[model samples]
Target: MNIEVSTANMKFLECFSSETRVRIIELLREQSRNIKGLSEALGIQPPIVTRHIQMLEEAGIIRSELVPATRGMQKLCILQLGEATLNFKRPEETHVPGCHRTVVPVGQYADYQVSPPCGLVSGAKRIGMCDDPRYFGDPERMNARMLWFARGYVEYRIPNYLVRGERPCMLEITTEICSDAPCSTSETPSDITFTVNGRELGTWTCPGEFASPHGKFTPHWWTKTQYGRLKTVRVDGSGTFIDGVRTSGMTIEGLDIRPGAELRLRIASLDTARHSGGVSLFGSGFGNYDQDIEVNLWYDHHNNAETGS
Candidate 1:
């Protein structure tokens, strides 16, 4: 029988030694306070509070910041550690499990073989529905599409665990996305979405325009078409979020790939009512996000999480 534990659990056990560290956590749980604020409230000296704060920061139990205050500058701190527990193993180690198979981060894009009912669009405004390379830059066309049924799933292999026999129970895949250029901003929300395994994850209604959340203004040309308003919707509730907000859906769970597994993500404007105005996906070559569509998977020793069981 095999049992496993996570790195997060050990860190918590290590913190139980210091009472000062524990009190700081209790205080921060109420509100974020600066060093001076903490000293005054706890009736401790600045240097002592600073020392304990340093230890907690090193332990990953809390984080600190230097923000301007009306009176002067101070180091503001907050606790980030959450509820976690650990299971103990005997000190006299018996059989040691060797390195586990792991999945490394990789990039994913569209590949074509047999698009049952979908198509493709190229840069410079050309749409390819059952298209040939000749449609690469057709002025009348401006979208790329490809599709299939039963075999509809696209493939993206993720080698989540890097060792020999370890498997992962949870899989996290994150990517910033948008697809098929819509004729108008109002039409951008109708894109259809799916995973590689023929499992219908869900759909995301993108913002009418791709706007930069970083405060940097989007370029003029891209504004006409919804190209800069980057919006992400999760496929599974367990997926990671982008811009610390959007997340991917259940692309894979209880994942058990050794080297890697093909990650297939397919997009279609399936909302017939809105997709009737079909759109074009402006990947890599032209967009403010300044990157081609990317997908990241997070897993451990064995199978995937949501799909792993």
Candidate 2:
């Protein structure tokens, strides 16, 4: 599970502090086991293993189910979170001086064009009927925490929230996303493009949709086999970048994000792409990152003052 360290439950932290408990977690990572199996594998007493299991369960790190055994019922222990990250730094700790930031949930897109094999879901449940294009216009889409489409784009209107008289010098967008394949499995490559204020920023080719141990925060009710990888795309004076690597020749000037300009960002799986594998966007409580799509606008207040319009 992705947990902010500052606000993490004390009990959760305590679960990781003991060596025995850590070993238990390691063993479970290989596969689920009963208390007897865990004790035998770890060479610990049955009562000691039971105690550790209780602590892990209380921390939401593991869960147990009773299974019919040859003699009687046996409790099987399984790991709940496939991964976990403790973010020790707070938002302010990593804040840029001249940057204004905003976060938009994946489902809050202002406009969209999607093909079939598409659907929307909140953290708890599906928003509307799946695979039906009409549901894309449903008002409940605003509550969407996750959404996927086989092709087309989702547009978002980002408010220009920078200081007065300051124009953006750079823009960065980060989100956890993956290719949307039929049945959530595909090895096909898809070129995902990004546009800012109608200007083509860049395109990144997604290798494939991932599967295995589902996303840590992904709800149990949802039946998806895999989740997205976190990605950060940036546009600046030089060029566009994905995860700090330059991917496009397009520069910040091409976008023309002026002080009063209406800011809009669009993510698309173009029809002509080499791989029309589709796309899935994840938000809080839906993806591995446990965050929404984040946009950061960096500007120069001093430069604005010197211009003196």
Candidate 3:
């Protein structure tokens, strides 16, 4: 997940600053190793290896477990972090001109139709019960930081902040997501479609759910094996764009987000889609981006602007 350089994460950053520590991390990524094995492989003293292991463990970069050995139990070290990104600026510090933005937490979905292999989790705890559709109705769902479903759609309400004379010229929705492989990781693709205010925008095919390394921000308690990739989908006066490249002929006028109108954003794995794999949406404290579903509206304030509004 994204991390800003600050006092709060100084220890975590420091763990990766040393060459020796980086080597140890690389070794463990290949396979879990005990302290004695690490010392011999790195040609370092056991005490020195222990020190580095302690620091890495404290930073949540690796985890250790006592396992049975020839003579006694040995602490086995395993890499825990799959990836880490250092962000120069905090989320709020980054902004674009002429855009009105709204951030929606994944768990705050206004409406949803999901099947089995679906679940919700807050930053620190599971929302209710996994794979149970009834849990989606729980009030605690509003606090969700992550959600997944094998099929169907999740809809979010986008706040209509446009004033009397403003007209939306562009719309953008971005989030960290991946194919939802129930109980496992897979390279199978999934076709995810997007709709804005009931107007079909376009569909994106997610390559797969990654599990080789754990999500950077995923908590220690989370034992799930899938993580997501960050993606940005945009729809403007011209057409739809995925990660800056135009992918659809549908344009902003089709959305018809008039002044004072309510806006809804829906993401679904349509039954008609070629690849109906599944979907996992990640928000704060759950994915590589450590952010929520971001909706941006670029508007024209001129009363005489040609926007259909």
Candidate 4:
């Protein structure tokens, strides 16, 4: 019942649109109430009550059930997610445009193939058609529809050029991981933890419960199935994710790149029963987003380190 709000739960925290929503949630928290009870207690019109209730339901703040009382029938609404905690931070002032240290490292394996259970899917043919069980993985595709997994592999070659005359220290590779996204358009929560050079980097909770372009980034007609939201784990020096356990105030460390060393990205998932919701993935490149997992190497190019926002 505890709702931890960080930038990750933007949608949930942003659901507070009106004071009615706040008051309605307060009343529902005490006990499940029918529309008539809410309307009478709040002294509001029936239409207003209904409108607020709908918004709360969409925000997943309350749940409703049918209760037969002295009356013929009554719909009872109760609070769902609770213990809400939110963190607000002031925006830092800085300016840097069209500058990302990352570069697309993997070349298109036009004739790539994945085993029956999985393989590389083309990013071209994947935008907006991910709800289907069959659109899992298909090579040579782009713009969405790409998924494949194994004991963890490596992509994005860290150029040996960085090892010219410096001592090798650390390696940094970035990618996304999943337990195995279910074959349906259902809400599936997962925890994809990362490890670097055999070191357990940390764990991240992927609350696969958001929206995306069903057919395109911003389609005109909205023909595709707008399912749960998605996420992209970006890689860099300070921006690296550490113990992001609470989805709030989470920070990362130990990402300093050794002057010269091969970096490896080791991704794995644990079904600790803590998240029995199961795993499901849909990215623009994997079957939908800008591209597959983006990875980059951060090192002291000339005795000076660079920073990313």
Candidate 5:
């Protein structure tokens, strides 16, 4: 997760300030623990542990759920974050040039051709029957927060707002995704390909389907899949990169993207490809990250074109 290193994020930064809170994070990382278990481990009173847990939850560093215990119920706390990147650069940094950002929901795809073991769900309930490709066309799909498929492609159309003299320098797409394995297993790997404007950008091999006791934002009733890793695919003058690691020789210029051009992004799990496990996409209220698929386009003046970071 990326967070600005500003006073506005002191809430999250403060989590590491106290030794007690830091120790709590360390314990939670190994495994989920209930409040009673944590209190005993820390040798602190239950009220004190509860306060630390509250702070962690408010900072989005941890999540907790109420589960039935031997007597009544216990609050089980789980670590929510794997890693965090502190962005020191300010948002208004002028050296970065002009940029535009757009967020598209996982279900707001312009086109799709998926196979069975596919379905869509909102935070509350399922949109249609599971493993039925026909449900992809459901009218209520626009409200979907999570979607999965065994194979095939799902495409989204990104809006292009570049005016006359803006030269495209970079395009970045960020989303939470994973392999769509049956029975919610994480052992499968899938080679997912990405395309922009019909040009293949690159293929990323997803490690596997990710699961947890519960997602930070996902509802408790739903448990088929848990969460996914957040990935950022970037295309620039030099090459295409996934999370800053160059994955292909494809460049922004090769995509033919320009002012007022239609930007169609397609994600596919072709059957012919090696490790064609599947694909699962998570949006706001469905994954650890409370966000939709985000796209950012950075540009420079035609007269002063430079490489993008």
Candidate 6:
């Protein structure tokens, strides 16, 4: 739902310009409604309502499907947009140099030690039996789009592409994650820790396991968990930050990062944590935001020999 004010997105931006469409968005926000229902509510004919629905659908703001009803079937319109962000600023990469971006699938974890209520699922089907820790080692896990665990940790190794004389300036990792629950409830909270190269970055307490309104990209057949909050963990020269707010004083320098050094990332919900509500990770096909774990490494091409360059 992120967009910029540009001609390229004129269609999406136009969706908000009409009064009927705005009312339609508001109506769908409450719940999915049939075209006839919306037509009656808006005090308009079904033909006009259908036209508005078409606009919204073409703009990717809403979705429509036919369902069984008293007659034959009814066109049901569902709101797909949960949130929208208008970016006024330019992209960071446009101004920053010596930056490397990598996308790692959630199931590609190099190491893991997870407890029960754990399993992996691809976009199509479940990888193995649920609540079985052994399935984490399955070769099919590489195709997994989402995974959850009641306890313990999962680790990933990101290859550093920096060459000699390129000093690591900052590291950022973004992912969609939430507390793990049997199904899903907004009450549970989990203290999740992020570690880079064995150096603790910080701990973020995810509010809950979310399941309402459904994820924009989550498959229809999958119904265990709906979506997760997007989180960004950043480490720079000054400190570590979660979503722009400083969480810890751990700096990038402390990690002993250097050219050609492999970055190991660990996400853990330790048993000793105060709120051990478990963890669930969503990748491309199973979350509101359709993306995998994204890692951005910003560097400076300077001869910082002190950093072992």
How many backbone clashes does every candidate have? 80, 0, 0, 35, 0, 0
Predicted candidate 1 versus true structure: per-residue lDDT over 1-309, tens digit per residue? 132254655444556677777787888866678888788888889899998888788766677744334455356786655333333564345343233322222123333222233344334432444424333334433232211111122334433334433443333333334433333333344444544444545554443333322212223333334343233333222552322233344434422234444444554445443433233343444444444434433233433564344
What does each candidate score in C-alpha RMSD?
A: 11.7, 10.5, 10.9, 12.0, 7.8, 9.1
TM-scores, in order shown?
0.40, 0.67, 0.67, 0.40, 0.69, 0.69
lDDT of 5 at 247: 78
Candidate closer to the true structure by TM-score (higher is better), 3 or 5? 5
Could you give candidate 3's per-residue lDDT for residues 210-264 as a string of tens digits?
Answer: 5545677877777774457666677777788775556788888788887777789
**lDDT by residue for model 5 over 1-309, one digit each (tens)?**
567888999999999899999999888866678998999999999999999999999999887855435566477786766456677887665244578899999999999999978999988999989899999999899999999998999999999999877888888898988898746557788999899999888887876776654777888998777887677788888998775556789998898887798799999999887998799999999877899999989887764344332
lDDT of 4: 0.44
Residue lDDT tens for model 2, 34-74: 99899999998999999999999998888775534556647
Per-model C-alpha lDDT, please?
0.43, 0.78, 0.79, 0.44, 0.84, 0.85
Candidate order by lDDT, highest to lowest?
Answer: 6, 5, 3, 2, 4, 1
Per-residue CA lDDT of candidate 6, range 1-309, in tens? 357768888889999899999999888866678988999999999999999999899988887754335566477787765445676666552334468899999999999999988888999999989999999999999999999998999999999998887778888899989888856466789999999999989898976786655678999988787787777788888898775556889998998887788899999999889998899999998878899999989887765666563
Q: Give the TM-score of candidate 5.
A: 0.69
Among all windows of 10 consecutive residues in model 1, the one with the lowest summed lDDT is 144-153
Between candidates 4 and 6, name the one with more favorable lDDT: 6
The per-residue C-alpha lDDT of model 5 at residue 25 equals 86
Instruction: Kindly report which residue pairs in candidate 2 clash with one another.
Output: none
TM-score of 2: 0.67
